[model samples]
Target: MKKTAYQKELAIKATQKREGTDNNKRDVMKIQSWLTLFSMRNPDSGTATGIDGDFGPATERAVKNFQSFNSLTKTGIVDQELFDKLSSNLKEAFEKPLVGNNLRSLMIEVAENHLKQHPFELEIQGQSNSGPWVRSYMDGHDGSPWFWCMGFAQTILDQASSAIDKNFKALMPLTYSCDTVGNTGLEKGLLSRYQKIRRDPSLLKQGDIFLIQKSRLDWTHTGVIIAVEGDVIETVEGNTNHQGSRNGVAVMKRTRSLRRSKIDVFSIEPLV
Candidate 1:
C-alpha cells in the first residue's frame, strides 16, 4: 500500500513524539501507566504509586516491591510479563471508548491490554505429551487441548469490542485449521483469504482482522486492526513465536519495505 503525503507526515510526527521524550520521562510515564493498570486488575494488590510520570526514588522502590512480591527479577525495570499483566488489567478497565485522549496512545494501550489477558497456552497446536515451545500462563492446567491462531485473534477482537461496548459482529470471521498439512496452512489458504479482504475495502472498518504470513509461508500470525492512517495499519497480533509469550503489539507502517510473505485482511460483520 502506498502512503499519502499526509499519512507520511502523521507517521513522522508520531515517531517524533515518542522519540522526543527524554528516556527518564518516557520510563516514568510507562511505569506509572503500568502501575495504574495493574492496580485496576488486582485491587487487592494495593494502590499504585500514583501516576506521577516520574521515575523517582518512590517509583523505584514500588517497582522493587512489586517484583519481590511477584517473585520476578527485582531489577525494578518493568519486563514484558509484568508489563503484559498490567496492560491486561488496564484494557479491562478502559474497554469503553476513551473520550479525551490521543487515538494512537489509546490503541497502544488497548493492544497491550489485550496481549496481557491472552493466555499463551491457547496458541499451541494439538495433543502432545509435553507443552509447546511456550510457557503456559494458565494456572495448574496442562497445555490446552488444541490451539487456533484465528481463535486467538478473535479473542482480542472480542475483548476490544467489549471494552468499547461496540458491536463487532460486523466483522466476519476468518477460520484457520491447526493442522500443518491442512488447507488452512498459513501461507496457502490464509494469504488468499487476506488478499480477498484487502481487495474489498467496504468490508473493513476500524477493528478488522489481518493475517500476516511469517516464515515458512504459513499464516503464522494474526492481528486486529486498531487504526488505519492512510496506508499504514496499526495492529495487535498473537503467537508469532512458539513460546506462548504475548509478543507485545506493535504499530508498523504498511510498506513494502518490511519483508514478509503476505498480508491477509478479513472483513467481519456484526452477528445478526
Candidate 2:
C-alpha cells in the first residue's frame, strides 16, 4: 500500500533538521513535539520536553537522554537517523502497508493500523487539539476549533481508498467538521438516522461512519464502526478518551451504546 502523501512530506521535513547550527524554529518545534509525544507514550524514554522551538541546553539534554534510552550514541542532535527513531510511530500509522478485499474491510484495517500507533491530542503552549497526529490528519492543521474526529475518520477512509485505487473524497469530502460529513451523508442519501437504525441495527455495517447527532440537523462527533452487536457498537474513533466526550483526547477503540446516545450512520456501501 502507498503511504499517505502528508506523512511523507512530514517525514521529509523532520529529516531536514540537522543539529549544531541555528535550526529553523518550526523544524525544532517538530523535533520537540515528537520528543514530547515519545516521552508521553513511553515514560522511560526520556524527560518530557517542551515544544518551544528552542534547541537549548534542556532540549539537548532531553535528546541525549532519549538517545541513551534507545541505546544510541548520546549525540544530542536531531539528525535524520535520530528523527527516524523519534517519528516511527507516526510513520507506522500513515505509511505501513495494509491489505483488504474491499473498501469496508479495508477501512477497518486502516483504522486498526492507526489505533496501534495510539494517536492523541496535545496542548502546546495552551493550544488544544494540537499535535503531530492531529496535524497529519488535519492536513497540517491543528489547534482549537480543529476538532479532529472527522479528520481522523476521513484519513482512515483516505488511506483505505488509496490502497484500493479508489477516490474516498467522492464518498465523503475531506473535512474536519462533523456537520459537513453528516450533511453530505444526508444529501447523498447515505445517512441512516438513529430512529431507523434503532429499529433495524443491521443497517449499520462494520466500517460505516457514525455521527453523534446533536439534533435533527447537527452532528458533534464522528468515528468508524468496527462491529455491531444488538444495542452496542464498537468504534475506532479519535479525539476521545475513557469518558467518551466529543472533546476528549486520543485515538481510542470504544464501545458505545446505540440506545443511549443519538447517533446516525453514514453508509460506505456506495464506495464498495
What does candidate 2's lDDT look like per residue over 48-128, in tens digits?
Answer: 788888788888988888888888888787777788888888888887888697998988998999999889788888899
Top candidate on lDDT is 2
Report every candidate's CA lDDT: 0.41, 0.84
Candidate 1 structure, TM-score to reference: 0.37
lDDT per residue as tens, model 1, 1-272 = 01111111111111111223533443454456455444544565542664444566666666766666676776655544565444443334234344423322433455556455433222223432112111111111223432344544544444445445544334433333322322333333322344444555343444455655543345455556666654456565544443322232221222221123255554433321
Number of colliding residue pairs in model 2: 0
RMSD of 2: 2.1
TM-score to true structure, per model: 0.37, 0.94
Model 1 gets an lDDT of: 0.41
TM-score of 2: 0.94
